[model samples]
Target: MDSSVSSLIRTSYLEQPSAEQAVHPSVYSKRKRLIDIAGALVGLGITAILTVPIAIAMQFDSPGPIFYSQVRCGLRGKPFRIWKFRSMVVDADQKKHLVRNQAQGHIFKNENDPRITRVGRFLRRTSLDELPQFWNVLMGEMSLVGTRPPTPDEVQKYDSHHFERLKVKPGMTGEWQAKGRSNVKDFEDIVRMDIDYQRQWSILYDLYLIFRTIAVVFAGQGAY
Candidate 1:
C-alpha cells in the first residue's frame, strides 16, 4: 500500500477516539439508554417467568441465598453491584482466594470446584446464573454487549491501558466471551480483547458478539 493510503487507513482504523468525543458517538449511536431499558425489561420478564422453577430447585439443593451480588467496576470506574443467581456456597467470596482452584493470572476457576452446588453447576454451565444482570443493563450500570465488568480486586491489578475499558459501560458479554470465553487465561489477553473492542466499537461487532455468545453459551464450551 502507498504511504498516503496506509496513513489514512491507520488514522481511520487505529487512532483512539477521545472519551469526550465518544459519548453516544455516531459510529455506535445505536447504543442508547432506552434500548437497554426496552431490551432488559423484556429480558427480566422472561427471567421472572423462569425464576420460580429455578429458585425452587436452588433453595432445595442449597440452604442459602437464591441470588448473589458483588461490587464490580462499571463505566469510568464507577462501582455497582452485579447480580447473579447464586451458583456457589454462601461463603464463596470469603473462601475463593484461600481455595486452591484459582485460575491463571488472578482469575478464579476450577472445573470441579468444591464450592459449587448441584443447581449451581447447572446454572454456571448454562450461564443461567447471569440472568439477573439484565437489571443492571436496564439501570444503565451495564450494556447488553460490551466488556465484561471486572471485580474491584481485578481492577486493582490492571495496568494503565486496561483502564481504557472503563471508558464505556461494562457489558454482560463481549469479544472475550464470544471468542474464547473461559479460555482467556491471562490478564494481558483480556486487556488485548478489551482494547480491540474499544478501538473497533460498532453495531455490527456488538451484534456479532451477541450471536456468537448465544452459541458459546449453549455449547457450554470452556465454561466452569
Candidate 2:
C-alpha cells in the first residue's frame, strides 16, 4: 500500500491539464462514495460467505495462499495493493516467462495459461477470483465503477492519454468489465472506453453498469 508508482505515470500525468479540469465530477461526489461504501459492505459480506468453500476448493486444487495481492496504480498513479482470490499456482509470477502473451501492449493475457490451477481456471472464468477486491473498495483504494487498475510496470509504458484513465480510482468493474472483458483485449480500445466512461458518467450510470456486470457474470460471457 505504501508502494511508489512508476515515475513514468506520475511525471507525465503531472504535465497534463489540471486534474480538476480533466477528471470527472463523479470522482469527488460524496454520493458516489456513499454508493461505493454501501456496495462494498454488501460485497464483503458475500465474499465472507463464499470464502470458506472457495478456500477449500483452492487448497485441494493447489497448496498455496488463498489470496493474491499485487501493487496496482490507482488515482493519479498512486500505488496500492489490489487483492484477489488466488487464481494460479503459488509461483505463477515466477513462471510468467513460460507463458506467451496474446494481448497487445502492456496488458498481458493468455486464456490458456498453464500456470492456472484447475480450480483457478473456473475462478477466473466466473470472476470469483475478484471477490477479495471488495476489501480494496472498502479501503477506498478502488471504486465500484472506474477503469481497471493497471500494474506499475504496465503504467511505465503508457501514453499521455492513458494517464487520463488514472484520474479516478480504479474499479472492481467498469466499462471494460461491463462489456466483454475477454473480447476487449486491445489496450487502446480499453483506454477509449475508460475515457468515454468518465465523459458519460453519472451516479445513475454507475448503478446501471453494476447491474449489467451481474448479468455478464451470470451469463459467463467472454471470460477466461
Off by over 4 Å in 2: 1-8, 19-22
Q: What TM-score would you give candidate 2 relative to the actual structure?
A: 0.94
Q: Supply the global lDDT for candidate 2.
A: 0.87
Q: Clash number for model 2?
A: 0
Candidate 1's C-alpha lDDT? 0.75
Model 1: residues with Cα > 4 Å off, grouped in runs: 1-32
Best lDDT among the predictions, by candidate number: 2
Residue-wise C-alpha lDDT for candidate 1, range 13-90, written one tens digit per residue: 224446532433412455555566777998899889979999999989997877899877776566788999999988
lDDT of each: 0.75, 0.87
Q: Which ten residues in a row have the lowest lDDT in candidate 2?
A: 1-10
